[model samples]
Target: MSELTAFLSSNVVFGVWGGLVGLSLLVLAVDLHQKNAHLSPMMKFVWALTVLYSGPIGLGIYFYAGRKEIAHDSIWRRGFRSVAHCYSGCGMGEVLGVILTVGLLSLGNLWVALASFSLAYVFGFGLTMGPLMQEGETFSDAFNDALYSETPSITVMEVVAIGADLLLAGSAHMGQTLFWGALIFSLSLGLFAAYPVNVLLIKWGVKEGMMNPKHTPGNAAPQTA
Candidate 1:
């Protein structure tokens, strides 16, 4: 009986860490698909969950379902190149951000680390796609841009959320409290950090004359007089 209890406890701890690692990877992957890309949000979500829960099986699913196909024809080469470049840049940014944040949190406390990560994700989703819309850069684009450009901000906010979670986790030592508190802190800080960066990106897009406000059917641009 004691052995069984110890095993269960160990599993719970492992599960918590696994969940955080999985979630961070999932968020990074989703952020790679730009808003206007030929992928659906639902599809991204499924991929994220798969990566989180299933490990190797999830990676196989990603290669099959999440990987984008590029056309090699000369006419489409430039566009494809642009898309590839954008995604690559986004991927690098997300990787760095997630690594730094997770590393710092891991050093402090495991629960706090996981909570910070969860909050980062929740807040990232809300800030990147919620109210502001910010010129429809997709959740992926916004997140990548934020991660890439605002590394310091992300690191700081994540640390703050982790610290807060640690305090709450220590006090209550209750699963529900830790989870909810982490979620709330992550969401709040994520929004606070992401919103301004999104706005800046929007402003930059507008200045660069790349702001596309409408998505015409069939993904075609309407002719103007």
Candidate 2:
């Protein structure tokens, strides 16, 4: 208790959290105001959630993942793009689960964590499947792709993100600022932690850039454009 108190009271903690969250919002604003990209409504929503969870890293995620359209023929480059793909769905789902289970439902930490994990996986799989289906693939094909790809990708992310969230939440700060700060930090933490697993998955050809439906051959451009 005393250690937590000391940690929270430190200036470094405030600076780190504030900087990350502020950067996240700034990144989101840029994505919103940029006129040239002309993202779809669904993509706008997806990037919004990415910014919300990604914190400072949100800026780079937007750059490498969405704005640049996850274009990479190289194996290593594809790996990061794959992580970006998985991160979006997992980020959105985990945040909602955390808020629902911990914030609204007032459940215990155990329940909160469980809910976060479940929701993350569900959202992750759905988002991954969407692009495949849009590529004129069958439901079964998309489902199998999602199951094989997003499962491991999201699992690594959720475990790391939830672990960080629970750790910070357990510190007993009842303030809204502190809770949100922890969440933002957890998002950044999850990104770094999940990178290696994503790299392996990409290298093994399990998943890569499936979030950008355009990346799939024959669906490389919008239907109208």
Candidate 3:
């Protein structure tokens, strides 16, 4: 843990990397708002939030893999978009749960993990249901869709995040830089862990994997499944 702490404390290197990430996030967010207004709000939010943690790599992927110019994306690209969508909501909720439980409340690891999982499910389901609701689906129907589509990926992400947190011993106070660093690292691992689950979900027709401009209420792109 001490070694990890020392590594993260390398201010010169971390500062440069952090600056690049911050710039990438800002550029992506602005581009989404100004140029990609036809995209669903959720997707715009996903790309920006993905860049927030994944940094330049996320930025590169967004430019190379997420653009709509290709017209028909491969299954892998579609799967990545699904995972990014899931990660945006689940990751944010997990971070908030950690802040509330561990940072503010100073709870034990088990309680923190539980609270994080609970919040992750809440955000994950809410994000998934939002687009369906926009398409005039009833609340119950949207809820069912979200439950079926989001549960497995969110579960895998939360489990991986918890494991990463434990392995890294990253339950520091919120005021500390280590807190954010640890959360970022753990959540990134969670994102990677959930990717295969999302691909499977796409393959099984349990989740939509298309990414296209929003010409209609729901996603306009065809589902890969």
For lDDT, the strongest prediction is 3
TM-score for each predicted model, relative to the true structure: 0.31, 0.74, 0.86
In candidate 3, the residue pairs with backbone N, CA or C atoms under 3 Å apart (3 or more residues apart, or in different chains) clash, namely none
Which residue pairs show backbone clashes in model 1? 31-140, 119-186
lDDT of 1 at 14: 51
Q: Output the worst ten-in-a-row residue range by lDDT, candidate 3.
A: 212-221
lDDT-wise, the better of 1 and 3 is 3
Q: Could you give the candidate ranking by TM-score, starting with the highest?
A: 3, 2, 1
User: Which parts of model 2 are misplaced by more than 4 Å?
Assistant: 1-46, 64-73, 171-176, 210-225
Question: Tens-digit lDDT track for model 3 on 1-225?
Answer: 778866655666467779989999888877666656567666778888889877887777677556654456676787788888888888888988888888778998888888999999998888888888998999999999889888999999999987777566555676666666667778888888998998899998888775644432443465796
Query: Per-residue lDDT tens digits of candidate 2, residues 1-225?
Result: 447545645567877866776778776777556532455555666666666666566666666655535454455555665676677888878888888876777788888789889888888888877867987989999888888877876887888889877887644333555566667667767877787888788777776543443443333355593
The Cα error of candidate 3 at residue 179, in Å, is 1.6
**Tens digits of per-residue lDDT for model 1 on 12-130?**
65566567657667654654444324444433453454344334444553443244432222212322222222222222333333344444433335644564455544554443344
lDDT of 2 at 216: 33
lDDT score of model 1?
A: 0.40
